[model samples]
Target: MTDLAKTDRPRTPVLDRVTLPSDLKGLSDRELRQLADELRAETISAVSVTGGHLGAGLGVVELTVALHAVFETPRDKIIWDVGHQCYPHKILTGRRDRIRTLRMGGGLAGFTKRAESPYDPFGAGHSSTSISAALGFAVARDLGGDPGDAIAVIGDGAMSAGMAFEAMNNAGHLGKRLFVILNDNEMSIAPPTGALSTYLTRLYTGGPFQELKAAAKGAVSLLPSPMQEGARRAKEMLKGMAVGGTLFEELGFSYIGPVDGHDLDQLLPLLRTVRARADGPVLIHAVTKKGKGYAPAENADDRGHARGRFDVLTGQQAKAKSNAPSYTSVFARALIDEAGRDDRILGITAAMPDGTGLKQFAERFPRRTFDVGIAEQHAVTFAAGLAAGGMKPFCALYSTFLQRGYDQIVHDVAVQGLPVRFAIDRAGLVGQDGPTHAGAYDIAFLSNLPGFVVMAAADEAELVHMVATAAAHDAGPIAFRFPRGEGTGVEMPERGEILPIGRGRMIAEGHSVAILSFGTRLSEAMAARESLSARGISPTIADARFARPLDRDLILKLAAGHDALITLEEGAVGGFGSHVAQLLADEGVFDRGLAFRSMVLPDRFIDHDAPYAMYDDSALNAAHIEAKVLEVLKIGQLDRRA
Candidate 1:
């Protein structure tokens, strides 16, 4: 760590002078560079407090300053792709006072949200949608909507997704006036993987890359006449880099760069020239380093892609020690164990190997793991193909990200009756990342598909059993969802059992009202059971492991044996509870005068906060479960606070 690194909160003189993008207009070039440095420091400090995406914001400090200074913003829309890199943007756009409150309840969103600020014309959480959104803004301006230039700052990782290409193709075809600044940092959440990444690397390592300073000065009309000759040579290099004309040029846009993203002198002049003279679409390839200034981040593997609240002096995170392993790790180990027994077991992830805990599986069976870069659509279909070929494929993805592949899931896997084991991680309300990243709809969506077996893990042990069950089942599609954090401190089993399909195990049996839990909420249901027992109301408790098959026998038996029944799950309405209700209605169980209720996530989006707080807001916690029981049985008064 340097002198700058030694101080947790570095002085921000230039940053303190201004609060908005317009403030950059009057500052000289030297002052603006100073501002960028301070902005970088401020970003690090804020994330050190709030704990979120750090590397991305650091990578784009200069670019963020340059874009705000060059573009008119609000009027001239600047859409940030994936929005993880928008922390600095948030500060400059008049949200500095609330910086520490980012990703917390009632605070600023971690991503760029339209409602958060005027400068944030488009919101984002997932990657690779910026170009399409920018094109929309451009088209909207042309058609007499909010008139302004549409600019999108996207990362190389986001560009690797298929949607970026789709948007680029359409933008090229339409020949709209748009700006796409590609922040090529050689890394996304994981080191970006694909042919395109290799191509971009070739551009960086190519002979002309060293002459970027001279070439950049010459390439723009603002420079002296001597640089014009260098501009011609640089254009030739660009063509070579893109093969038959630069890739963006072939897509009908003016392609500029392989410029230094961190250098204000290079970025400012180029952006000024583009903003002044460009007529059609333009793609600026700015090469940057992830975790640009901070030594601890630059030296780390992921460049501080994400973190918990950390000590700025040492860059050590402040995470509480948990005795139990996380649900993600349990799934990973169980899959690795199963793969050891079966050679045909393959793993696939859409640019989230580490996030889904598939990195270990990839390391153990290198040939068997496939990372389809940010392309969930391709990942699902590829897994279907592997399954069709008689190989067991586990397509692991976050529940929210899996939404991108729904078409593939419905047509390619479900319709084809392929045996693709879908390991759905983050299957409930995700903390900090907020509503955009919430895994709330998978149960409802997957359960509706015929021949699709949907299951949820009630605990880490159950997750292991589901993994084995998914591996053994060679029928149609099978999915098992598990939530985001560490599991209950349950003892580990020697190996997982291939649990019986469509069957639920009873945890406890008692009188009056039975409580059925579908997923990790089983723990909450049990807690509620204890409270109920104190009032001489011992409610039966069971885990409905399989949601799609309805756990028919268990549900029907529970309803018959109890006066009032309640269903608990971490998903939204129309999920396990709805399925259970439909089964009861079909059987005329409701006609037997049995009171029933279903506790689930409310019908609106829950903002970022502590996981327990978000669950409390959603009214799916143990206290809420107890209240539902009291309400249904008409016993203890509804006093959640008590």
Candidate 2:
């Protein structure tokens, strides 16, 4: 056992007893039950100190142990979809001591990361991608003449996604020995939705029919061949009445049980049976409860979807004391304020009401607010329909999620010039959720859309104005992106008024260089300005509001006047910074070779950590910005003591 897995404190034996999956080979069936109990206790204890995906980890304990025992992990590939439930998998795979540092800077990642451990076959943060990735591994193994099994453990909620269905259809047609375990916890962050949820509900309720058919078959076996044939025909008719038969069987997968996932006795035996079989594309449906063992998590309204540090016994969340209202809360209130005054105002989200701050709007104006169950494509078009019907619709989707609806933004909203307001949350490198959930591509994608009005909030005050600006503008599709967590604690304006379009306001004036920043990084630019001022270097700073319009006049004027232009934004390659470069090239602003750098998220995906630490690591912090400006002016690095 690794030293990290061992502690001086009296620890539970079930988890501590086993270091590798091979250790489970000696344990009897009875001992497996006891092991599951100890594992659950350990998981609860670990999450109490370091809050993360608690409910998911607890729910999958028995199944995880069973799979590890049955399959040779780090050899046989086991792909966990979304990776929120991989905490147990991580603990077992030699990262036990580092569990406390989950979601922190320079610590263990919160999700299944390929770079972090060899045990993680594929890295995932987004949902409904396991089956596709697992199938790829299965194909690779076959080509290499390897006989390892590829298993994809996907949740019932993730099954609702079109991508999951697409993978299933493709997997069925190809017909390989790939195994898909449908972990039916009966929930997504919220309750499951669409036709898939309905099918699962039918499967849950219609179990008695299977028993009746089995008993009828036993009774018919005593009869002669002619009678038996007729009875068999009747039995076939009976099975047609049950759900999950036609839908999955039609898709070409041999579907197995809606078995109890918590029962190690049932789970282990069923797994062994499936593993031994030489079938093509089999799905084992296992039902488990989210937050099964922990009392507090089990009782929470959302089933502890995402939680902060909490008292183990009391169930109260441990949060840092804050003087300012969260940005999400403020946005929610502002949306409500707008909705109250305008009868035509409507709201939409892609499976994140609570996260996107549309919960209140959903509660008060149920008809107007639509939660489109992780389908970003549908959400955009649905908002377009509302706009077409003379309603003012605000599509509140996270910036990263909007990437899914890029085609929709261009074809449905922008092409027709529908007046749809987009409240884009998590517009920057969001803390902890990491690159997969970061609002990195919205500015780039939305700006390129022909009739889109792309704006970024400088602070809480500017967010209010932008919200007003979006609401007031009926020209086309307008988006205002904001960062996650709290605002700058700035005093809000009495009334939100529209800012002039295609214009930027200067924060500070300087001659050496002008920093043209977008989105939440404006705060870092302010800090850089102060840093520059103290070092006898005065640099001008401007918050460019419209990324699509490019604030061309403002940027052109700044470029011509200043010695160098510095563009900073919290996004990936194709965002606001790229547009600035294109405009500069076209205008011949860089004819004499302007010393500039586009500060963006690196080419690789960042892991989960605090927002501040993530920014610093990605070189999006104030000190980095200050140093970059100094470097551009040939002033060398900023002296920290000076």
Strongest candidate by lDDT: 1
lDDT of each: 0.89, 0.81
Model 2 per-residue lDDT tens digits across residues 146-195: 45889999998888777888999999999988889889888878776677
Q: TM-score, each model?
A: 0.96, 0.91
RMSD for each of the candidates: 2.4, 4.6
lDDT of model number 1: 0.89
Model 2: runs farther than 4 Å from truth? 1-10, 207-237, 240-244, 592-595
The TM-score of candidate 2 is 0.91
